[model samples]
Target: MTTEIHVTTLGHWSNSSAGPTTSFHLAADDAEVMLDVGVDPVGRLQAAGLSPTDVTHVYVSHLHSDHVGGFANFVFTRSLLNRAGDVPLLKLTIVGHPSVLAGLKELLRVQYPEREFDLAWVECGEEPVALGGQLTMRLVPTDHPVPCYGVVVETGRARIGFTADTGPVPSHQHDFAGCDVLIGEAFGLRGDVGESIHRRGHMTAEDLGELVAATRPKFVVPFHFGQEYADADKRAELLSACGAAEVTTVDPVDAKPVIIGG
Candidate 1:
């Protein structure tokens, strides 16, 4: 089983680059899975050379537009691209917290009132959903203002934990314990953050550092940046803080897809 993680970033700490916001393109050799459909997503994913026909699943992090805003376009694109004879349109599943169904669904219907495809709305709760091949995923509740979740993608060889939009509660991260790759959001200035910031659920670099120590991930990829920082130094600290453990930096926009386990 092989998995490819292509990250076409839109907006980051400072810039949006060529992509939309923070959507991810996770492809498992035979199947395609998209995480989050943030604003301008189809354009971004297409820009990355991937078409809607290739995507089979979409797991959203939250109700934020930047996360699930492109649901309609994704469906529309699939409708246009996968109309080959004898083959059904790609099956699309949209997963998200149950609390966000009204908002995300309303947006979807608004864009495509004629809902015209094989789509299923799975309110991601406790069941382990199979993502084809050797990949399986589970969405866990994270500490955010509204209902939000971080994804845990596991393969036979390794496991990857992605903290979408979370605060500092670390309680939700326990499921990620001992993962091979931990992708955490680093979205704030350390000393500069006001007292009210941490309470908002977006993890600061410091909070992520603490999480890395507690969770004991072999590798840490810090994502989601703050507007004030230009360098990756803040995210780099996860290396020193973790005592010689390997650390890789994922810029808001990276050209090549990252493969966790070869």
Candidate 2:
């Protein structure tokens, strides 16, 4: 009865990186979900061998540009493709906090006033949202300057947790507990500088390590790193901190699918 969930980090680096921001693609039980749109999500999705038309749902964690900058493009591209007869216009569901959804809708209206797309908007809250088939998702509030949320997606046999972006919040330990795979943010290394970032609503490697120890997910994937941390040595240092918690740590590779479960 084990379910295999395939997760691909479409974009792992933070805004500082001259690359894609933060986005993840999760394929489970016939559900194709994107954790965040980030910038150029459509391009990244194509590079990962996934067609935009195949995506069933997109979950936005917050309103940060880095996390949702590409949403307009995604919608516009889909509409354009349908108009070109390249694909049929399918209804796409977008889930996010009410505020985030409102803002994104306005953004689309402002960006493309003439185009109308097939999109269903769902506001995420404490209730578990049914995502077709046996898949369901629950949203948890995170500690950030702006309103943000983390998500836990359940696929019958496995639960996948994603900490979109946030500072150290103790409640997360319980929120993400028992997840088969937990994708947490480790924005920086442990040090004085890291402490500053932590206070600004971002987790450092040490913070993520502590969470891993407490939540004890079967597998932990760390991401949302600054460009400097992308260096091999710095990346190793961050992984070591998480490994110290005696849990398996997986480094997210852009566009590479990491299979979770048996």
Candidate 3:
């Protein structure tokens, strides 16, 4: 069987960025998954030519505002579409850490007391789990100030690794070995304060470069760029340090989805 992974970058910045926040759309055949539903994810989804209802599974790496702030919006929008009586409510499966899911439920309950949305929440751990009937997913703990995880998605032929938002978790490299594409964050450029960056639970350009060098993914897609490193040169400098043969930086110039097959 041939499996295809289609990854679209909806937004590529941390919460602080003036632009849309970081989010990714990963799809394999008929299964559509959202990597992280950042603030205004619905708008970002539309911008990327995707509908909110098209998302079947959502895998959140952490509970930061940039990652889950738009959870209610996504649910509400999808609910509205269902209420219009034009289509059935799309079943949304939310996967996240136990505590994160708990907090999310409370947040939703508090915000929309009168209305209930059609969705299911799955609290995930470090164990590998099967998703969408074909993809295999595993969450590995990452080096962040708060509890966070790096997601690994694999099919029979290819694997995609997402660092989410982390400083450095060298042991996690083992989980990402030989991935077809590795999406890592570059929160700051080389001259930034290493301690400060790590303290904020983010990675500097050098940090991501080191990670790519260690993991050796076939392709590296750097996103979640800090304001100072928004320029392509800054991103290029980071990739140069990675010493990888193929590195891709997604920007306005090239907003097309990256396709990987297995």
Selected candidate, larger lDDT, 2 vs 3? 2
Query: Candidate 1 at 128: error in angstroms?
Result: 2.1
Per-residue lDDT, model 1, residue 198, is 66
Number of backbone clashes in candidate 3 = 1
Screening candidate 1 with a backbone cut-off below 3 angstroms (N, C-alpha, C), the clashing residue pairs are 10-16, 10-19, 10-20, 13-225, 38-66, 166-201, 167-201
Error of 3 at 121 (Å): 1.7
Sorted on TM-score, best first, the list reads 2, 3, 1
Q: What TM-score does structure 2 among the candidates reach?
A: 0.93
Deviation of model 2 at 48, angstroms = 1.4
Give per-residue CA lDDT, model 2, range 99-174, as digits (tens): 8899889989999898887789988787888877888889988888999999999888778999989999999999
Score residue 25 of candidate 3 by CA lDDT.
86
Off by over 4 Å in 2: 1-3, 82-87, 244-246
Better of 2 and 3 by TM-score: 2
Off by over 4 Å in 3: 1-3, 85-87, 247-253
lDDT for each candidate structure: 0.66, 0.84, 0.76
Listed in order, each prediction's TM-score against the native is 0.82, 0.93, 0.90
At residue 164, give the lDDT of candidate 1: 88
TM-score of 3: 0.90
